[model samples]
Target: MFDCIDWVNLPTFFSMLVARSTIAPVLAAATETEPEAESSVVLAGVLLSLVAIYFASKIGGEICARINLPPVLGDLVGGVVVGISALNLLVFPDSGALGSDSLIMSILQSTSSLTPEALQVTFEAQSEVISVLSELGVVILLFEIGLESELSELIKYGPQAAIVAVVGVVLPFTLGTMGLIAFFGVATIPAIFAGAALTATSIGITAKVLAEIGRLSSKEGQIIIGAAVLDDVLGIIILAVVASLVKTGEIEVMNIIYLTISAGAFLVGTIVLGRLLGPYFVALVKELKTRGPLLISALIFAFLLSYVAAAIQLEAILGAFAAGLVLGETEIQEELEKQVIPISDMLVPIFFVVVGARTDLAVLDPTVPSNRAGLAIAAFLIVVAIVGKVVTGFTVFGQPDIKRLGIGVGMIPRGEVGLVFAGVGAASGVLSDSLQAAVIVMVILTTFIAPPWLRIVFNDSDRLETVQEE
Candidate 1:
């Protein structure tokens, strides 16, 4: 077509042509933005989930505090309140609709009656982000624990901590494995995995309890912290071996031996090497002009160690914990803690709520045949989990003021580590659904009971100390 163009507007016409050519493709891609838009809804759901968890935790914590209980109990209970098992409060959408239009969804919008598939879909969709947040929260929490911890104290009590860790790991692993085999009649791999679940004591929970009671710096608290850290190292080693067995269907003795040595080496090596180098790194960062460079630098260090630990097949938290230990020894320890505490407070509750959300009482019902079987197995495992850890407290030698019972109870909460073990097993098809549910039951009991019980023991110890002084 021959075009008539005004001389002054010629540039405008060409510009419009260029704009039309480029803008058409851009507008075409706008159709594809629907997927991205859909993702925004999912993001909103995640944010809402967080908000629900936060308020639930706050309310739960307040109620707990009113009754002289640990606030974490409330955080966990709040998780249950919003979780699929109880209130069905926070469900994500599988379709782009966010499930608002679905009759079932609408009916249960303010109540707790969600379809299993919908809940699961939502959970899996948001699982990755929530998992990362939960993990980072615990890492910060552990780092704080490390800051409050002294290396010399960790070393002085190292032998006793080692003994307590060994006892704690062995008893739970043995009892859990045997009980799964004998009582639940599960496969060897699942039984081993179940045992593995019981082996880790959530240092986050134990440390928080001790810190709240002002015992975190006490001799016994130090021992418990040391032992819990060591217990995690050992638990991961066991998990690695069991996972390999599941994959290869054959146990590799040398592989297990190598993993054990490597894990130990990595932990000790990090401590020794970090002790030599951490101060220099901190000193280098101290000259930075940024307002929060020190805190960021510490976080970078923690994250690097976490990545290293993961690369070597250990838990990332181990690396974070190691980073804290190293940084805690530096002169900037006080400043780091002051800066990090607010971050820890904000993120830690999310981790606890996630732990609680994983609990499903529906799986433990006595009315269903399979659930009854799971319930029975769960009951047995709970007893084994409790008594085994309690006995390990007595294994600590010669610290009469140690509050051995408190230490044992401190070891009780299986927390996230247990869930991780169970999850791996379930994913690998090693743990049947019911078996996983049973493990979840055992974890919840331990997680719920320990905080208050530990507080009670600590109070009793305080009273006894006062009486003796009088």
Candidate 2:
């Protein structure tokens, strides 16, 4: 009878065994008396998650390329796919999403590194560490965007670029905002969502389209690129303004004016100051010698502006984007390019995949009204996104020697940055799911459409070299 009772209480015995083993050190660590044990655990978990985000991002990118999509698409997909799997692996070693979690991987992980009594403490440490690591991943991703710009071309073509960017951003925003308010009968939040969708522009994607048709150096091409860059800066400001108005129920016109003025002022100031300080900044970075002071300093620079951007209600990426524009004109561009491009090339894909992954098509059920509404929104958006960019082809109004339309068409792809907007908006809850999908679909369509369209418009191969000489 006593033996039967013991058998019945086996689970209770195991529970106490597990609890007794983990409690003492955790209690000690919580009280901050066991500082060494706690630090060691937190440090290990953070290192593991960071390592995982990078490696998984790289693999996902390569795999995505094999399937004919942007490596960014892969990385984003990989982050979530890999992240979910990693989480499971952390919880249950044999979950079979992949091979057994490696011994090396386990050692680096606070959770798996612990034995007997420290298990729960290690797990608690890991959750916090993982969150931090993911935030680091987002930071690195934006920093990469800053490193990819070209300032000379951006400047030489500044006026037209500004015109196109402003036209592109302003028109779409106005149209989208009005369309929702009048046609859809949506409230201010949804109307803002529509304008946010209009702010989407993929600078990298547009450049590649022009290059594909060898029109990247055309008068129109330069104008499109320059304007698109500026357009991004302006668009972000507009987004901040709209977001602020939606949130606070006041569109303080003075505040809006001040925000706009500050953005322009920051751009002008950074360029002037950075030009004078460029040499010292570059030399200082070189002196730091693998300490990554330049990169770290750049991040601090990016974040400072990001905070400023956010304070006035803009996406932090916009601040980072402006910082990149200044940095591009500095003496450090080459070294910055050399050191950061690969990492950017790797992590950027992760940002893309996140966009695709967040788009759960199931939410738009084939048989439902929301699904129909989503499809309709996507179609209208596709037209607006394309027509709006195509009109930029006319920006070469004063310069007819260029294939302005070709450049305009080339400027169409939404690429990574556009996806970043889509992802950030969705993640931040500023956009409804239907709205998110509509914008992403429009971005993808524009990107895919431009390549073929560019071939048709810039059909002459000789003009490409001639444009270079002129």
Candidate 3:
């Protein structure tokens, strides 16, 4: 065998073995690095998404500010422009958009070695991250609103606010439900679901506008804010009941009672307990000598309460609001408010923009044969949506000087809350395509119109007040 082997080939054979050994480790290291590379791609996608969000927010807000409209509206418009409805830049999987549909995903694919399967996974993860950020943005917004609010004034107007909230729910639910049933010939369940959609009042949007106009501390503003809080509670209960009905074809009475009681108990308990512990909270913050002790401690308190709220089937924003109300009574309240502003400036716009982004304006196209019926139903819902909440202003008694119209107009935009209802109905398969489209149309118009309309009403009211004073 030794004689058969060529002496000249020995060195080459030995080199081939060495090359195989070296290549194995290289391949193994690359296989190990694959997951890490995927992670990098995911992070890159998120960074790009944030970039798009910030750009849209600033551009839209600036344009709106220049036009004498609410900058929040501009943020929303910016979101719409970049969203699936227009640019397909910031689409989400919840909207039935594929990874391949996003321009951002395409860029990632071209510049990197992301496979189709991995791209889908990354798209979902990235969307989820952005969505959570959006949710946090709103929670922070509501917390800021609570900080700016007067607890005593809110309590003073509590009864009136309760009445407003109740009337807002009952009137819209009754009229919207009955109108769909009688006028649109929609079935009972679907009509009820659609009616439920009409009852939502976007506190975040209304609060932002009011705060912008320096009306956040006004008597009317207090009433609107108070009512909006109660309305949110009621909306939760109603949504649960309706969703239950959709799934099981029957209402869960016991579940409804539990939700109502729990909601009431949680709100009252948080306020009472937080007030009692307010001084201690201040003292604790004073003891801490850290970079952001005050802000960090406050956010921790807010997040704890928020977690509790979510655990109990209530909205996390409610807990955050309660936490703000509690902390607002502390000595550090003013300083804390100052610290929170910058954070709010960074985060709050994300909420408004994401809301606008999620809204599919395509539903409003009457040129589509299928959308014709929806347009008609949408018209009816819009009329009810406006009138139902507008009349609630008149329901306020004992405050004759309060801006009743402003209060009503403040509640007009259904915003993200209305979209929740439409989404649930669509998911349940209870809503017809036309009916779902109709609900979406109503949401879009009400959301787009309310900010500007509220500004005009309040500005006019202010002018009238000046004239009367003169």
Q: What is the C-alpha lDDT profile of model 2 across 175-229, one tens digit per residue? A: 7777767776657776676666666676654554454445555666667666765
lDDT of 3 by residue, 1-470 (tens): 69987789999988998999999999999887564336788889989988999999999999999988999999999999999899988999999998999999999999988888778888988888889999999999989999999899999999999999999999999999999999879999999999999999999999999999999999989999999999999999999999999989999999999999989999999999989889888888889987999999999999999999999999999999998888887888899999999999988888888888898888888789999999999999999999999999999999878889999999999999998999899888999999999999999999999999999999999899899999
Q: Model 1, range 113-162, lDDT digits (tens) per residue?
A: 44544544444455556667888889888888888888888989999999
- By lDDT, rank the candidates, best first: 3, 1, 2
Separate clash counts for every candidate: 0, 8, 0
Clash pairs of candidate 2? 21-117, 72-349, 75-350, 76-350, 76-353, 76-354, 77-353, 161-227
User: In candidate 3, residue 345 scores what lDDT?
Assistant: 91
TM-score of each: 0.85, 0.65, 0.92
lDDT of each: 0.81, 0.61, 0.92
Error of 1 at 307 (Å): 0.9
List candidate 2 stretches off by more than 4 Å. Answer: 1-150, 178-189, 204-222, 248-250, 283-315, 322-327, 330-332, 401-406, 409-470
Candidate 1, position 317, lDDT: 83
